[model samples]
Target: MPDVTTSVRRRAFLLWAVAALAYAVDLGTKLAVVAKLEGRTTVSVLGDWLVLRVQRNPGAAFGMGAATTIVFTLVATAVVVVVIRYSRRLASAPWAVAFGLLLGGALGNLTDRVFRAPGDFQGAVVDFIAVRDFSVMNLADWAITGGCALALLLSFRSSPMTGTAGASDAGAPGAREA
Candidate 1:
């Protein structure tokens, strides 16, 4: 069996690699959308079910909090810092991947918030990929959402109090043995 340190290191490497890939894809898609659809109208990709519509959003996901660009920027910065700080302790592959996705998504949006348009540290994020009856989002948004979902699933599957692989009923206050 591999040692704990080796396992952790391997997970950390996976986290960084995945983060880099996610960030790259997010940025690339945003740039391509902006360049191609700057002045064009929405182009339906799936017969109105999905469309390509370029938009600059100075807000949170789904275009909420339009007036809180700076605040979100600060929050993203904090998230990146916290993720990096905690990544050193990540021993699980799934958790590492989750954190990586989150970090990449945050950084992808943070780049636009810092360098896009309007002004520095207050720029709008380039958002495209509109879903009918849903919201217009980008790759970063998907990554973040996916990461959150995975994290939630992992949390629900593990022991809550002991951080173990399975739930324990042995030490319950009032429990019956099977």
Candidate 2:
């Protein structure tokens, strides 16, 4: 069996560190954009395929949840706390990374919502990396999406059938599918 105590620490630290790194990058880029562009400049790349267009988001993925920053922030904070508290339950690196990416993205956006806006607790998230006809996103957002995708891939790597003594335990009353 894996060392549950050590695994717990590994998961928590890794997740928080990943999140912190992501938040730093996200905040730094947004600061640069705000200082240099102030939402007035656009740098085109790939012939209109991509552009650095500054935008503020107060919502969820793809610009959803604009009306609920307070609620969302609280939920995000709760998620971080829960994940950190339950890190021991994490069984793999992919899960650890996924949790970290999500935590970092949430905290990154939450920082904006808490301190960069028209009012307290109503700040807007900085989103760049505009895609024509699609929505604009930032690094934090990408990290969360990418991390979740990677986690999903990892989950597939060890389905229940491939689990420890899976076949031997398959006949058990509590056996589960992968």
Best by TM-score: 1
* lDDT score, candidate 2, position 67: 92
TM of each candidate vs. truth: 0.88, 0.78
Give one digit per residue, the lDDT tens place, for model 2 in 1-178.
6555665566667777887888798789888988887648788877798999888888876788899877767876787687666555554556777777877777777778788876578877888889988889888788778777876776676422122321245565546554
Worst 10 residues of 1 by lDDT: 159-168
Q: lDDT: which candidate is best? A: 1
Off by over 4 Å in 2: 1-4, 158-178
lDDT by residue (88-150, candidate 1, tens digit) is 666477888898999999999999999988877999988898999999989988888988898
